[model samples]
Target: MKRPNGEKNISSTITLYADDGREFKQTFTIPLKANTPPPKPGYAVAKTTGTPAYYVLCITVPDMDKTAGEGFA
Candidate 1:
């Protein structure tokens, strides 16, 4: 759910700065799509080095799904 400020409940806004000291705040929204069955509940964000990585390496699942529990919806 989004908060009053339009920020997602699971995340918060943060300021990012470049090496040049330029700072900016960006609003990002994560999508939920599972191609394979979840192994466990919770989520993960994998970091990669080089070539501006961060291309499709994350997980977002409810606690129940991560713990082998049934999802309510």
Candidate 2:
């Protein structure tokens, strides 16, 4: 999915297929801003001042066993 130019935020849904024929899905939104810090272990700041600008979208997925297999396991 691609964010249109000048949009304030972008969002998309992601789906993951497990080995046991189960599927997990989640939607995420990322805001576009300047002078903001990126996630840990990131490449560059999100459009920081006086630096080369880069847009970053970080997605954090929880432990799969706890999220995908809640009670079915």
Number of the top candidate by lDDT?
Answer: 1
> How many clashes in candidate 1?
2
For candidate 2, write residues 13-61 as lDDT tens digits. 4666789978767544555443433334533335545557666665453
Give candidate 1's error at residue 7 in angstroms: 16
Scored against the true structure, residue 53 in model 1 reaches a CA lDDT of 73
Q: Which candidate is the best by TM-score?
A: 2
Worst ten-residue run, lDDT, model 2? 36-45
lDDT of 1 by residue, 1-73 (tens): 4334333334445567889998766855555344444346555667777787765556665554344346454
Error of 1 at 45 (Å): 34
Q: Tell me the whole-model lDDT of each prediction, alpha carbons only.
A: 0.55, 0.50
TM-scores for every predicted model:
0.21, 0.22
